[model samples]
Target chain A: MTGDGQSQARPRFEFRRNTWILAAGFLALLCAVNYFLQDNFFEPGVMVSNLTTFTPLILIAIGQTYVILASDIDLSVGAIVSLVNVVTVSIMHHLGGDALAVAAGIGAGVATGLAAGAANGLCVAALRFQPIITTFATGTVFAGLALWILPDAGTVQAPEPVWRTYSASFVGVPFVIWSLGVVALGCWLYSRSRPYLTLMAVGGNIRAAFGSGLPVMRTRIAGYVICGLFCSLGALALTGETATGDPLIGIAFTLSSISAVVLGGTALSGGVGGVLGSVLGAILLGLISNVIFFAGTPFEYQNLIQGVIVLVALAGGVFVSRGGAR
Target chain B: MSAARERTRSGPRWYRHSLVLTLAIIVVLFAAGETLSPGFAAPGQVIYLLVTASLLGFVAAGQNLVILGGREGIDLSVGGMISLGALIAGNVMDASNAAILPALLATLAGTFALGAVNGLGVTFLRIPPLVMTLGMYGVIQGLLIVITRGVPSGRAAPMLSAFVNEPLVLGIPGILFAWAAFAAFVIWMLRSTAFGLRIYAIGANENAAALSGVAIRRTRVLLFALSGMCAGLTGFLVLGFSGNVFIGVGDQYMLPSIIAVVIGGTSLAGGIGGHHGTVAGAIVLVLLQSILTTLNIDPSGRAMIFGGTLLLLMFFYGRQQRLRV
Candidate 1:
């Protein structure tokens, strides 16, 4: 089994080698820039806050990595976040915000995310809808359902103990750090799993994978399911941060996650990237935003600069990878 | 036999006959509207629907060209182009109508230049059309924000407003005449010209067309430029209609334009549809909106319906082909 796995993964590892290196180097550079620009960037408190800010996007980008690696895309992840956030918050609110209610709400939110992912997966992998447009349409549907559930943004304070546990540290280590550790470990383990390789194989060449006796449809569907699960987790993280439910909160996640995935050196063409790069990519994006904010750029020009930088980063990543391949 | 072969070659049996489906849908939507609200079938209401549909139709015309140019061609920047065009034209036009022509020309030229950049990125740099146009959307949006400082200040030129709103013939708006002429021109360009033929050939199969001597790069560039110009023109029209320009004036049209093209039976896979169907599509969408509005559906419900409809349409049209383009 080890030999079989090694043989199957070798070609992909070769394709992905330089991207991981580039992503790591770029992430380090971004962190260094942020440290210099931010007066207290190295403080544990500041670092914890930054990590908290980075956590949701990191999770979403990881989920997105699976879909993109399978040569499919999910524009509806943001909508799933929106839906799950609303559903969780609403449930907690209706249940009077008790500890048990909060637990139940969290479970419901995860279920909503899984359900949305399953819908998208069925449409793309089974029903044969175009991935981009299908997801775009489904995103609208999810967003609408969210709006229906909560017609307006509302604040529902979870029981004090819930958020306290979230923000609080166990044994002088932050809960966020523990959460990140668990997430990272989970991703690492999954990366080495057979299903991950199957997804990569399916994405690299659907016909070839099919010929090689891979369950192409199931692999693609599983990618979406995994993505949905991560998006729900991101939604939960967002709930912890905001303690509020807004149907519109996750609108920015779709493009940002896609950008993070691309910036992480994952080819949009699929089959040649990993979750670790996406984690760094999400951090790099957050750090870039922070650096821009701290550098005293006018508020209006910030969006412009960010847009230009993302385009440049995208173009640069594409150029470097192409050159390396040649 | 040759004719039959050509028909089969062009598209699937249902697609070749999709115009009938579109017309039938439009008729049904109209009937639904009439049943829901007695005033809906009135001539004034019909004219209103046509005028609104004409705006989307113009944008769809350009979008059809880009989508038809193949290689997964799409332009997400249409909304940005429309906004930028309107902003430029609105700012340039003083109370005096004299500034209108120059403003219109400048808007066209500026937007075309931007579209050319998208074309270059897609064709030369090998950026996927999706990412390239999305990036262009961001750049245009950011530039507009910076230039306008989050507040747009300008009134529509008097002449433009008059042309757009005033009745030119038999209680029909003057804009209808302009729309009619533009539609005629687009139809001619797509069907009766060498450029049109090349667009079809390239959309059908890029490598095959290129090998057969089609100027793939130039045609693609022109296609995107044309999409930009159409968006620009819609911008000016929108300014005339609203008598003002704002940051997000073009936001609503982007998805609707794509929906219009797809409804008209133009394959997202490229090379298998035409502008006429898009025209019908725009009308159908407008009529659908009218019906939805009359039924008093909330905005959220409307969004769900719109998305659900798009999914159903795609499933119907796309399921025939198993291979993902």
Candidate 2:
């Protein structure tokens, strides 16, 4: 198989696999922080609650990983999430919150995400615009459309208790956590298998990948579509927590998701890192904020600390690679 | 004597003239506005136009410099730095003391420091410019919000305000002098300095620059720091012009700076632009906005037009580059 010689040549995958071992120590530090601060520290219920709170962000980060891994970016994901949430809530209200409306809302969210992703793909692949600029412009347009659709923020008219329970937890674990399993399985299969390998090859060296007869454009477009799907899922999860339609709700989702992706050791250069790493990175960030909350640090301090973490983590990656310590 | 040696030294000339075409487009757009609304042609209105474009002009200059230096270097934190700098300056300066120099220094220093962090991240950390600056943008925005607590405080001294708002000789706005001085400084720096040569070399080809023993990391850091300093200075100017700093001021500048840089015919991929083009680009953008406002176009229609124009410009720029070969 072409994979054998290729796999041996790549130090990145090995680095990625072994990196999780070090995460245990970081996770332990987080546990220690939580224990010292919060009363419910290490409790099963609290852990589950933390998972629930982080669900939407992790979901969005999963999709963001796909795009980032493909050596592209999607700034409109947050805007897409906002658009999806607003649209879903508005549609449910107008359609009387029936099962069909709920289904339609979910479908609409997917469609919106796909359309936005496709636009990004077209800009990147066909128009050859930079991912940053194209996505930035599309983000504004999508957010504007969201505002036009839902001019005001309001609570959705759905039966709250059912959704609250369904969204919050199932069988003592967050429903989002279970959903995480599904996403993890999918991510694992994609990343460890042929299509993902091809994607990584494409991202790592587009010219080489193209010359090797890999469908570069198709793979990239597919990556974006997958990202869009995950973003929709993120939006759906967010609906349960918010219970209201906020056209601007996902304001920092893009930055936070990217932060999570980077912290998870995903190379922004693409073709490195996996969805699981991103998920853990999201959890790390979520816990950092959680620690801040429990420690009574101001929200501003949380942001400052997060910024520091981003800087340190990014710096850490470079130093490791340079020192050959990875 | 080889074509490769010569061709590699300079990019195609016509593509660099995007600023001229951009300016011409704006003039044509303004002429259309004059036909539509005669007030747009008045001296006072034109001065107002110059004043409005000056801040963005400075931002475009900073942006173009970084992009020209290479490594996909664009400052996403320009807006955040502007807002944060203004807030820091306003909060620290005792308006009662009117210690203008110190106040401005403190603000500028803080902004420079914020920008320095961005530089350090991009250069030393090996983070991609897009992500590094983006992270800084988030950090700065968050810090600004926290410091201001969602409401900006303090006001600029009357002297500064008058200087910014009042027109200078020949009915020219004082902002024009400021812009001219800045543009001249940038032009001189790019043409004469070793640093400028490194920026050109790095932008042209990073590998080549490295092979030539250029300090790629240091140049990138300096470029990012300089961009931040320019952004900070513009923040102070913004305060003088607007009389107060507001939360939205920084975010508003982001897209305009980028749009100005690209429309000025500065390649997003870097290594081929100057302050002259950026200034022209900024003027064009300001002119477009003024004409749209005068025509009483709805905001959405205006956005569509702006976005459509940007796409069209990109297309034309792309086509011209392809044609050159």
Candidate 3:
């Protein structure tokens, strides 16, 4: 029935079909590499550790996929994450990390993320500012606000055992892994849903999508809201893992997240990839870094490898899209 | 067709000239400063403003070249190149071996090569400029960190600094002289060269440009390289200003570079603006910062103000562009 609908809806199962195959093949490659690089890569214990470490990045990539799929970009997600991290710590510190207070902190953090995302959306969709420049400016503002609120490092010691064990593993499976799995599953479901299909059409061809009366602006606003929510959740996961917050910690994640999204076969042009692709992308990146860690690669070489991966991935994406016609 | 074109051009006459408006804003800012503190109106402060704005001014010029190349072309790596360039120059011309010309040339070459790598990644490797530049930025930053071991590296040659520090004829800062010379070169290139025409055509519509026999790829590559050159020269200026090469020398220039270009009335939509507007935009940006500094606002507050101004200008200018189209 889905295949019949797919044919009726669009003749381009070729794109999706090929992309799925590519993603699976890439995942296999990554797993194999991870096996050889890390001694316990296949073990549940190491897998759990990798999942916990990869959670925040995966979360950020999930949000970024939406923004990029909308044909706009958000450079400020890292800064927004930093802001959330700092704010959550400060709020929790003041509220003594009570259960209610933790919820409030996360809520406030999500609110800030939405505000930043809304500002970017308005700038891009309304004011017509280039996403790169507008987001850059707002990123600075958010980061500045973060610094202002928490000028120095501090602790947000959760009083509740449940909260304290947020990052803990169960049966050798990290809680972060579970959380990421849930978020990833939600995103995958959304991507397959009608709303996300409409979003994809909008990004795929704005003029056509607009002519179809798809409520492009509303879709864009929703995309940003989703991005904001994911970023906030990523911030929470970051806080759980680190126990302490630094306003500057989110800086490095920005490049890594972008690299992951692009590497995972998502068309930078948008409307072409799913959250599973992004998760694979994040995992691929995480594994690459893990390889570097195991191989005793210097920090600079690791950075170089990341730069190479993004370039190669981008080149691959462009090549695939053009179908070598160029 | 010409008549229709003329009508199109004339329609954008009054409101499209935002450089004039930005100039007005600068004048008002300066006048407000004068009224508030007569000391600020002194020639010294004006000279200082010119000097301080030059770095961003030059970088903005480079950014305009890339932005105008149109196909989502921007050197996010420009800021990183500036830092990397400065660091290389610093390392090469260590405190004992402060050979000026060698240091300058070496830094220029190093930055140019870095910029070329970005160009290669985009043009040859077919990476999107945004992804390519973003990744390169990180790689460059990490490399710099490794090289410097997270500390400020290299001292500016005192003689070179002094020369750069020296005022030119009419008491203008020597940095202003360098800025003017570079701007003159860019403006001349824009007006008198085949490369400039190609850039304009490519930016206007890459498909049309390709159809018209413009070497789209070559033009893009050139623009990226030129952007690198601009960042390199700006690195030298940064060293002179700071007297030491720090990891963050390129940090503040990134936003200001883009803002300067846009404020100077260059369109972010590409193919519509020039280096002249970027120079004006740079002056406007510096003036805005100067006014904020005069107000004694905290850096964070100043950042907020700067962002607010950018959003307002972008909104206004973007509307104008849309209306024209």
Candidate 4:
């Protein structure tokens, strides 16, 4: 009934044929550069701190990978994060900063993220609004809602246990490290699943996929939903990190996530690349910022230099992949 | 047979004219404004709306041109270009206003160069227009930061300030005159010029246009450059209107310009719309903004409503397309 039947029967298990080798290499290079730029770059404390910083982006970028792979985009992911963060903090504050309240807040945050994703999905896939602009509009709505919920940035001290557990280690390993492992494993399992292939097919050619009996709309919508879910996770991580509700917190994540996806070698046109590459891309971006800061570049020029580096990385990835493909 | 059905199903002659539909919307919005507050119909208020719309009109003109150039053409860098242009012009123009012309020229030239880079990447390198322009957006923004060192300084030319605020003729604001002249020139260029026809032809069907000997690559590149120039001009106007510059001054224009074009009935898929419609669309948005302000809606509520309106408009436009199909 599907092309996957024939492809699955083949002897070669060629998963990740389109994995972003260039991005992985670039990330490695940046890691090496960072090692030299910062003192004690490999120290456990520094590494944990760095990984914690990269975690939320890693989560968001991974979700964005699904949407981009389905040949769509979700600019609203950052907004979803903002909304979830504010909602989580507000809920906790309202319900009192207890264990049950924090748990309930987390649940509420996840629900809000899912709802936003569903709204974007319905508009883009069901309504057939242009993906980029639709998500952009929806993103503005989400950001507005976030601001409305928390008129301004403020701190809501989570129950000590919440931040403690988030920052603490189990068996001498940081909690973030364990969370990263869980996320990586989840992505790995999902990549091997049927829905992932369906998403890839839909992105590769929507008409063709539909003709072949794939649930095109459903797959695309699911991609967005998953993206929203991951953004919620990112928000949870952010809450742990900042313990605050800032309507403006996730604004930078929007472009940065897109950059990470592209930097991971996911074609903006879609149907290529994977989460692994996006993870590497996210790390690369984080490291680039770190290196800039450590190198003592004027604080003002930091963004300028960072932008230049992303462009260079993007161009390099494109050139290398095109060269390799040819 | 399907094509015939599409033609018939397009309904009345007025329905087929998106510009008419947009104009009708403008009238409706005006009526709503009047009903909500009688002062909305005042000549002064109308003039204010047109003047602000014209500022947005400049940016939308460039955006419309790029969108009309096809192949998923969109210039996300317009906002950055606007900011860069205003910042550069503000910093360069001296107190005596002697350097105004040169500053304007330099800003436009700089913007043109940046747009050209985007054009080159999209056309030759086969980069998606969105990504290329977005990358350029980042680059321009970074350069702006580096140049301004975070704090934007300098003043708008006094002449520009006078021109913007003062009435030039018959109680009409001077900026309206500038907008009218610019709009007329753009409309003429788009309607009567070979380049304009090429733009439309390429947008309608790039492969077909190429086969028919349209300079697809050249036209697209030029269109982006032109869009950049429009942004530069918009920046100059913004500086004049505001009497100074800031890092985020141009931030608000990016999405609104696209919204104006979209509302104007320019298909994001390209081809099938005109600058005249965009003019109406710009006015409509300005009118809506004024009404919202008069109602004293919070900025967040305003943003949400604006976004919701954009989605609704897109949904309706998309439904029309689907029905035609």
Candidate 5:
């Protein structure tokens, strides 16, 4: 985030200032290619299905954007998701799967996630443990706890109605879309709040923000807290989609969320980006895989192609972000 | 002249004692495990633990260098490299004893090249080392899938397995001997070589190191490549230890490698840790695993205890050095 591109006022220059635009441009191009390749890409049903599948990533990226905005990284999101998912499902199993049981299970999951985030915040911002290792340690702990709680996978699931609700639509709009709308709206509202600006200032220059009397510590904690909450929410969506509890479920999402965050135009060093681009970034990542799938790539080679493209997207952001470095 | 070498080899007295402290903890923990389980202190069990330790030692050695090189240095692709190395070793040797040397050279050189690409992306392309290696990790996974055509197959030559498991002398496994030689070479390189000082300088202050004419970019790339080679060695070791290959075999080594380095008291911020401590660190981790298993604590509980211990260890080591004004 340090010594990045200079701020420019013109529309053309503004395009360079916003690296998310790169993600957007790529997403559009991919969508176009995908649309031509897949006959049903634009169909309402397929669109709804794709949105539901990708919503969790978008949500996690949004959360990650907050932490990265404050120049901190959370490696524990995937572990938190696993913990929250298992905790939710196990609680539902204990409570006999009633509606009230579902509500309590979700509440417990979210609360547990928030607590984990606060602990990460305390370690990094207060105790001054290095963010990467601290989170790695905590992630191991959280994943361990998840394995303890649900030693066996697929033995517990939220009731059928939960998945039903996730699969169902309201007024011709999918539940996932509505949830995404609320999330996007919430992010927009938070962007206008004092804490959001405080986080931005802290990320842009920590000593300067501290010198300016900003409550840097609290804002940093809040960033991690928000990240934890969103991760838990993403877990909830995952639970609904998979409808089962598995300790190993989140192993892949940890890095994928980081990829989505970086791909969205947010600087890895933090500051100078928004959740909007992250949302697009997450969608862009989803689309890349989608495009690859539609392009008739074999299942074996899909991962290789995805990895190459993700690297390209990262390199794409470099020309703009590294301008000042050169 | 001997005193000067000693000072360079061990650094200040305080740094030397951290190794002693870690060894002391190892002894205390071993004693505790023996008290809990009668056979825990037996040469057989201890040797097995050490055999396990050496496999991880190879990885931590590489991790030790990259972390020492600084700039948020971490090799997320070690797991991938290990898997790739294992697969390549398996395919080239194709169960033949005669091809072992070629397999060894090929695995090291191949993984080092891929690791160099990790370096090129990180330095020349200005990609963050963390993400660059991460993407490479996925790429390696994809490569694994493509090469095996979905099912992993191959066998270690009989001698290779014997080298890993059978005692070479004094009831010591050949792998341990291999580990001792590797550790000595790495320690020598770190203490005696000009590149060692350059690594410390760059980790401490990149701009100042650059201003002082240190080849920061080249050194970092070389360091990453070395880390890759280390992971490649781990893969080779794993193939011998297990007698075959498994999909994603190296994935489990990822966290333990870093944990070994950090627990060895190597600073995560870089420049302040060494491979000597990491040997004890690897032993400490294997001991933890063995002790936890003997206590009848399940894997989850073992993980929790390991993580909890790691957090406590962080309380002692790797915090950003606070300057006293």
Candidate 6:
């Protein structure tokens, strides 16, 4: 890997051997703090509610892990979430809120998500457009489409049962937990699969990967498709949580999810991290916000505080990982 | 790495013709817009668009330099800087004519310093520019609410608004002259100055530039600072033009400034574009915007059109000819 004389000169962040360890420690620390700050912090009912709130970020961050692992970024996933949410909610509304309608709605929503992912993939992998800018543009388009479908927040709503099922429990576990578990597990299994390894090969060194006869373009495209799939899942959860088709709701999730991805120990540079960290990172982010709220931070300063904390965490990770080498 | 080496000094033939192409776009947009919207080319409407275009031009100039500095050079914090600059101006001026100088100084100093921090993170801490600026964006956004107490305050001094909105000479807005002065300085620096050359060298090939004795860190930091200062200037200008400010004043310009740079034919890959095209690019963007405005599409439609146009423009000339081929 270090054979390239040219790459020797380029500085790479020497991340900790296992970032999930750091994530777990931080998560534990936060959980302990929550125990003191709030009553019944560990109660299954309260925990499930919190996890429910955390579901979308957790799922989207996992999806982002794939793209970032491939050394590409998707700025559009949040917009995708918004678009899917509106699409799902709208379809359900128009088709009449029965079980059949919900099925159709979710199916259509997934299609929208896949379509967005394909657009990003084609733009970057096929056309070689810059990932950051292309995704930004696509995200803008997706958001606009969301707005077009749902002109106003209250114009359409997911049927009561649609959301009820989301909030409802199954197999002795909450729906959020079940969904989060399934998605996170999929990410875990994929991380060990050949396709995931191929993505890493591409990300670690695109030229080398190409030279080795890897399906460089197709594998990279698959990463975005996976991201899109997760974004659609995120939208489903969000629609359930909010019970409405709100075009603008998912905008903030973009930055927050990125933060979670980084915090989870996934390198923005790609090929060096996994979904486990992202999952924990998303939960960690949720906990940080919870701590801020529990600490009674004024509404105006909550966002600022969370941003500062995340930045410090990022800078601190880099600083520590460098470990006096600098 | 080989992909980068493939880029020779002589760009595609179209690179040489970008300025002409940009001008042609502006013309076509004007003709089409006039035909579709009636009165689209009226002198008053055109002047107003140029005035707004100038506002965006200032930020795009900054974006141009950053992109030129290479290493994934992009200042995503620009939107935040613009918003922060506006808030700083609003606070320092507090609606008083006498406070204008102080407001200008504070906005410049504050944003420049903040931007430098971004550079330090990128250079010293080795944070990716996208992640660094993206984080900075969040911080600035949160600071916006805190600074504004959740609502913006202060008004544009009537005198300042006159300078921004009213023609000062030959029926041209004062802002355009101001922008011209700034653009002239920027262009001259890029073409005539050693500092300009260093950024270009650094962007073109960092290791080579470093081996050749260029001070990479200082130049990189300086570029980010300059970008911040540019965004700050736009903030004050925006305040003057609107006669007021808001938490999201600079948000609108975020994509447009980058779009302007790209549309102007500045390659996002860095090292291959210039401010002259960006200036033309700014005008092109405003013209397209005007046409879209006249299209009477809802906000959603406008956004989709803008995004669609960006994809087409980039696909046409900006992308690497192909990923594998």
- Could you give candidate 3's per-residue lDDT for residues A30-147 as a string of tens digits? 6887678776788877787787788888899889989888877788889889988887777766777778777787788888878878877777776657677777777777777777
Candidate 5 docks with a DockQ of: 0.47
Tell me the spans in candidate 4 whose CA falls farther than 4 Å from its real position.
Answer: A1-16, A319-326, B1-15, B319-325
Residue B288 error, candidate 1, Å: 2.0
Residue A272 C-alpha lDDT in model 1: 69
- Evaluated against the true chain A, what TM-score does chain A of model 5 have? 0.94
* DockQ winner between candidates 4 and 6: 6
Q: On residues B88-142, what C-alpha lDDT tens digit does candidate 2 reach at each position? A: 6666564534766877898778877777778887765556677688778867766
DockQ of each candidate's interface versus the true one?
Answer: 0.38, 0.31, 0.34, 0.38, 0.47, 0.52
Q: Which residue pairs does candidate 5 place in steric collision?
A: none
**Clash pairs for candidate 1:** none
Give one digit per residue, the lDDT tens place, for model 3 in B17-68.
Answer: 6757877877887898888767887888888888888878888888988887
Error of 2 at B79 (Å): 2.2
Model 5 lDDT per residue over B138-179, tens place: 788888888888899877877788888888899998999899
What's each prediction's TM-score?
Answer: 0.93, 0.89, 0.90, 0.93, 0.94, 0.94
Cα lDDT of model 6 by residue, B223-294, tens digit:
989899899989988989887788888988887888888877777767776678889989988888778888
lDDT score for residue B225 of model 4: 90
lDDT of 1 by residue, B1-325 (tens): 2222243246567776787888888888888889888889899889988989988988888999999888788888899989988888898884459999998998899988988988988777777677778778878888888988898867788889878777778999888998888888876776667787788777776776777787788989999998998999899888888899899899789878987888788888677777788899899889877787888999789879977987887776555355432
Cα lDDT over the full model 5: 0.84
Worst 10 residues of 1 chain B by lDDT: B1-10
Candidate 6 vs. true structure, TM-score? 0.94
Off by over 4 Å in 1: A1-18, A320-326, B1-12, B323-325
Q: For each candidate in the order shown, give its overall lDDT on alpha carbons.
A: 0.83, 0.74, 0.73, 0.82, 0.84, 0.83
Better of 2 and 5 by TM-score: 5
lDDT of 6: 0.83
**Which portions of model 5 miss their true places by more than 4 Å?**
A1-17, A323-325, B1-17, B322-325
